[model samples]
Target: MLYVMILAIIVLVYVLTRLYFLKREIKRTTRQLNELNKNATAKKIDISYFDRDFEKLAKEINNQIDLTKKAKAEKRSTENELKQAISYISHDIRTPMTTILGYIQFLESDEITPEMRKEYISIVKNGARRLKILLEDFFELSIIEQADYPMKIEMIKLNQLILEVLLGFYEEFNKRNLEPTIKIPDNDIVLRADHSAVKRVIENLVVNAIRYSSGTVTIQLEEFNTSVQLTISNSVDQLSEQDLNHMFDRFYKADQTRTGKGTGLGLPIAKSLMGKMNGRLTAEQMENQLFMKCEWGN
Candidate 1:
């Protein structure tokens, strides 16, 4: 009986030793697995096993990347085409316009009836002015579209500059039978801007107001702690939401059928000029009126 019991004890000890080594081996394998996972993550490897789901996801990602690349290429091509079209159109229009102006000058030099001469003179003047406006708009658009243009900024008195621009338009206001009410502070309000660009912005707004307004247009200047706002309000027929939204877009005319003569680039040029000067131009519609605002930082 003693011999049997000693054999049993020896067997039990052997079983316990085997279990201890087995547990150690398991711990080592687990540590190695964790280290492999860390290395894979650090290297940004797609260590996922190949499955139907993974294949589908990779296909989707590739398609999205290809789509984005195609869209960018198409956009660049469209812009290039637009630039070429503008160049061709401007050149073609100038030839006939110049010829018309020359013919009108010859007619004026020759002896003619007063009525015929006056009519021809009016037509010539209008045509010349239209051609000039078109050329100016074309040049402005090219400048704005160029990637590199020097933006020289300086501090300018906002109210004084606006006054100067309005003074230049006084005769136009009188001719149109419209009244301009200007409200400006006595003290000068200074804003950091490009003077030429800012002046063009105000001039465009004033001209637009005169073109659309029926009787009176009001100009107001207000200075805040960090910005200055110049608002030009004009009384006009109610405008649709669509017109308000595209008021500053290139070649956008509010009245489709009411055309006399314009390049339809005034507001767009003004907006682009304002952007170059680090300013903003916006329009607001109210009851029977439209308010165009040009704001600049102090």
Candidate 2:
């Protein structure tokens, strides 16, 4: 009986040890599974952060593209506005000009009084001339805005050409009771350019000087190695800075309401012609006078 009891106790001890080892293994496996879950969650968070950064970069790129598009749209809008304004002015001026011409032609008949005939004839001639100038300006402006206008260039004497233009205006200058003073080099100054276009530009400048000068108009010709400059200056009362800024803009009249007769296109046309010829036209105010300067290059 004693041997049987001892054997039973040993068996009990072995069973208890086996149960403790089984419980320890179960706890270790649970801890390993929890660590694996934590590692997987950390990797997911890193992927989420990368996704947010990528979205932010994409948004920035889209914003830049939108800004560029807006700028281009604004530029096109401004160009369209300029074209519309020119069209409106051209259409509005023609009707009045035609009526003035018709009346002048009617006054030439025998029904007009003899004493008033000369004065009527002068008025008609001036009106017709002014209308012609306006039409010419409209045509030239159209050509300048075109992309396919031809530029016929040649080598010509700039100095002699200027002198010829000034001589043509001699009678007008005398009639205005204004003295003409010129400063030119003794030798001929040659330039590679479109001669006809340059002649028109110089003529416009000189005529503008005559129209605006109170007493005297001065012209100077200066030659450089690669370019030539012609300056025409006329004395006038002080002009506002606003006039100086927009002197070459089309249909911009400084004294539009005043009695002085001008279509306000002479300087603008001259400036456009110069641009077509790859030259430049600019204006300056000095000593209470206005100066128009033209520069041509080889």
Candidate 3:
């Protein structure tokens, strides 16, 4: 009878101890839950409970909360980008449209001379061209940003494409009074890319060079271990580091203070298209030259 009483007392103490711990964990979890509900930006769930099950529950809750925060951050970033896109579109189109309208009004004046009328007509035509370029760039960028956009990737002759793009700009280069030196390897440097996209990227780079070149332009191609590099460089007297950094930014104008002749979307479109083709476009402004580089895997 004495031994039976001793064992019964030990069993009762163990049961009470378990009950006390369980109750304490429940109370602590309830308080944490209340605190979590009250704090909008609390990033963690603080649990002091010494139970495995409760710890597991808290960890799962924290995991879910972290996922939610990540999703919210992504949504915010996307929203900001869309807002910037809209603002850029509005400003770019508006300025050119206003110019066209003003020129039209000038042409319609009652006592305009033939010379003045011809000049106004030419101005209107130029404005229309600018508007068209801006709209086309905006369209291409939108297509690139779509989540399900597909690229028809294939092997392309990188050197041949660069030569072709440069030759196509011969007339424009002549008009700008700029002579570009082209250097490509005798052997074909082939790369895996979308042919049309690659052509467009090179064309954009050449056009940018022509637009900003002060004296001469240089186009060079070289091969690396796993990729090929194409660089188009031009002399520029007054380009800052900030300008070089934001060169590929959407609708970033180096001369934002003045109404310049670039759509400001060329480099950005080129960069985005390169990314789609598993490549990259970058720019660097050295002492008196701006180098535009395109790198793609072989």
Candidate 4:
């Protein structure tokens, strides 16, 4: 009878011991969670225990925490980009509007000769055109970003498309006094892409090259086994490495002090369109020459 009683006591003691440890571990996990609430950082929970359930729970909790962190990071980045866009829009719009207003004031004055009045009228018209372009590009970028852009994907003959785009810019090229050297493959290099998007990208790159380049602009097209590359190179004035890095950033200027007459939306819009078409746009600066490359998968 006494041995039986002793055995019952031993069993009770074993159960009590396990219950105590289980409660302690639960409390520890709860405390960690409370601490996480206090501190903004939702760190992973670590606990040493002899159970697979606790380990699995900890891992799942860690995954959720990681997701939370990622969400926070994305939110912060979006907020920053929004702030940047607003500032750039204000500066870009105000500059041209101010120029137009000033030119109008000059036109109102009676002291100006006809030649001077004609020049001022031309400047005012140009300013108005620039403002219109700026607003159009801004809206286009928003449409591309919001996935509202309509695309018709088809087989594209790159050489022919590039030729057509360049020919359209003949007057601009002549105005800039730039003689572009064109090297395209004799054989057709075809890519499956959106025709309008491809054309827009080519046009943007050409416009950038002609506007910023001084003497010679070189445009080359190369085909790889699996991809095609269109590169436009030109000699630019005072283009730095930092400028190249942010060349695709909207409203970025190589020389911020200059306040260029360009809307600064060309490269950014090109980049966004390329991304939508599953292509890549990259740029590099060698010495004073800037090379803009667009790669499309065949």
On residues 1-298, what C-alpha lDDT tens digit does candidate 1 reach at each position? 9999999999989888766765564465445446645664222113133446544654664566567668979999879767854654465466548767776776867677788787777777777776777777878877886768667688888889999999999899999998899999999998888888888889989999998887779999999998889999999886889999978765566875323446667888888888887788899988888999988877
Report the number of the highest-lDDT candidate.
4
Query: Positional deviation of 39 in candidate 2, in angstroms?
Result: 47
lDDT per residue as tens, model 2, 233-264: 99886578898897887766676432246667
Q: Residues 185-291, candidate 4, lDDT per residue (tens digit)?
A: 88988889999999999999998888888688999999998889999999977877788888988777677743685777889999998998899999988878889
Between 1 and 3, whose TM-score is larger?
Answer: 3
What's the CA RMSD for each of the models? 12.1, 18.1, 3.4, 3.0
The TM-scores, one per candidate, come to 0.68, 0.67, 0.82, 0.86
Estimate every model's Cα lDDT from 0 to 1: 0.77, 0.75, 0.84, 0.87
| C-alpha lDDT of residue 76 in model 3 | 100
User: Model 3 — which ten-residue stretch has the worst lDDT?
Assistant: 40-49
Where is the poorest 10-residue window by lDDT in model 1?
40-49
Candidate with better lDDT, 1 vs 4:
4
Candidate 3 ranges beyond 4 A from true positions: 1-39, 50-67, 214-216, 238-241, 285-289
- Candidate that beats the other on TM-score, 1 or 2, i.e. the better one: 1
Candidate 4: misplaced stretches above 4 Å? 1-22, 40-43, 109-113
lDDT agreement of model 3 with the native: 0.84
Q: Tens-digit lDDT track for model 3 on 212-270?
A: 88898999999989889999999996898788887887778787643687778888889
